[model samples]
Target: LVNGVLVAYGGMVPFIATLAMLASARGLALQITDGKTQIVTVPSVLDLGLPDAYVLGIPPLVLVFAAVTVAGWLLLNRTTFGRRTIAVGGNPEAARLAGIDVRRQRLFLYLLSGLCCGIAAFLLIVLAGSGQNTNGNLYELDAIAAAIIGGTLLSGGRGTIVGSVLGVLVFTTITNIFALNNLQSDVQQIAKGAIIVAAVLLQRRTVRDGT
Candidate 1:
C-alpha cells in the first residue's frame, strides 16, 4: 500500500517514502502503547534460552548471527536472483534491456526485506522480553554505516555479506569501547558520521580511478 501510494504519487524515492512511513509507524506504536514499553513473553523454542544455552562456549545469538551471515553470503553469491540483483544495482537500464523485470525484482526484494525485519523484530523482542516504539530507533543509520564500511558502493552495484558482517563487528566493537570508556553519545555519533564520510570518499576515489 505504501509502495502503491508512493508510485502513484510519484515524487518521493523509496528511501524518503520509507522514512515517512517509519515516522507514522512509530507514532501509531506510541499511540497504541500509550508511550509505554510492551513486555512480551515468548515460547522457550523461540527464545533458544540464550541466557543459559551455549554451543562450543559461544552464545546462541552469536551462533544464530553466524548462521544468518553464511546464509546471506550463499544467497547473494550463489543464486540467479542474486546475479539479477547485482545487474539491476549496477545498471537498471541495462538490466531492463537484458529482459530483467526491474520493478518485479524490486518488489520481491522489498518483501524479502520485510521478512527479514519481521524475523529481526521477533528475535529482538525475545531477547529483550519487550517491545517499544523506540525499539529500532536509528537502526537505519547503523545499517547504512555498516554497508558503507563493508565496501558497499553508495551509488549501488557492489557488496559482500562477509564484508558487511565484518563492518557490523567493527561498529559493535567501537560501541563497546565507547561504553567502556564512558564516552558521550555525541562523541559516538561524531565518530560514526566521520566513518561514513570517509567510506563515501573512498568509494568515489575508487570509482574515479577505475574510470
Candidate 2:
C-alpha cells in the first residue's frame, strides 16, 4: 500500500507542476497579446491545453466515472466471466472443482482493479484542475474502508457494488459535516479512522449472526 501510494503521489507531483507551468505560460501570453491579438491556441495535451481531443464532445467526467463503475459491476455480475470471479473469490477449491481456472480469475481481477485505479487517477486530475503529490493520499484506505463499511465481508465474496457506493457516500457525508463545522484536518482523520473500525466491527457482528 505504501509503495503504491508513493508511486501515485510521485507521478502526480510532476504532472501537476507541469500543468501549473503551462497555465502560467498561457496566462502570460494572453496578457501580452492584448484584446485584439488572435493567438490561435493549438491544443497540446502534453501542455495541458484543451485540445481537439477534448472537443470531440468527450463524455463528462461524472459520466465517465459512472460508466467505469457500471462496467465493473457488469463485469462482476452479468458475465460468465463474472461468475468465475465470484467462484474463485468465494472458494478456490470449489472453483477448481468446477473447472474454473483460479489463477486466471485472480489475474483478471487484478487487471480490473488496475483499470479502475487508472480511471480514478484521471478523474482526480480533471476534478482538481491540477494534481498534487498529496492528492489522493490515503485514498486506498478510504476505498477499502468504504467497501468494508458497505458490508463487504472481509472474508470476501459477499460484497455488492451498490453497498460500496453507499459506503463511500456515508464516508463523504461524515467528512463534509466535519468540514462544515471547521474541524481540524487531524480531527477529521481521527474521526475517519474511528468510523472505519466501528463500521468493520459492526459488519463482523452482522456476518457472525448470518444475516
Candidate 3:
C-alpha cells in the first residue's frame, strides 16, 4: 500500500523496489528450483511492446519516466509522508522520539523502493528490447553514484529528486559524448571514475567551505 504509492510517486523508490524484487525472486528460485513438476516463467509487461526505432520507442518511455520523476518530486517535497521519510532517514532515534514509527517508515521505504523497481523494470525491458536476467546489474551503483555526485549526502538526510535527475543526465551526457568521439571503453571507465572522485571531493569541499 504505502510501498505502492512510493513506487508510483517517488523517484528512487522504483530502483529500491527492483532490488528487493530481484532478491525475493532469487530466493523463490532457490526454494522452488527442485520442488516443482513444471517450471513457471513470469513474463513482464514491457516484453509485449511493438518493435520500433529509438526515436519512436523513446517517446513513450520518456513520458512515463518524466511522469514518475515529477510525481516523486511532488511526493517528496509537498507531502507529510515525505516529511516523515526525511525524519526517519535523518535520525531514527529523533524520529521515534517525535512519535514517528521508525519500523513502519523503514518498511515502507523498502517497499516503495521495490515498487519503483517494478515500474523501472518495465521501462528497462522495453528500452532494451528484451527481458534479461542480468539486465539491471550495477544500476543501483550508478544511481547511488549519481546521487552522491549530484550533492546528495551519504549520511542520508538531504537530497532531491531534481538533483538526482540532473546527476543522471550529466553522467549519461558525458558517457555519450565520449562514445561519439570514439573513446575506448577503458578510457571512458577511467574518465567516469575520475569524474566521480572529483565530484565527491568537490561536494566535501563545498560543505566544509559553507561552515
RMSD value for candidate 3: 7.0
User: Which residue ranges in model 2 land beyond 4 Å of their true spot?
Assistant: 1-59
Alpha carbon deviation, residue 24, candidate 1 (Å): 1.6
Best candidate (score: TM-score): 1
Off by over 4 Å in 3: 1-58
Per-residue lDDT of 19-71 in model 2, one digit per residue for the tens?
Answer: 45446645665566553333333333223333333435664665676677798
Better of 2 and 3 by TM-score: 3
Tens digits of lDDT, candidate 1, 119-142: 777667767778898888877778
Clashes of each: 0, 0, 6
Candidate with top lDDT is 1
Residue 184 of model 1, lDDT score: 96
Where does candidate 1 clash, by residue pair? none
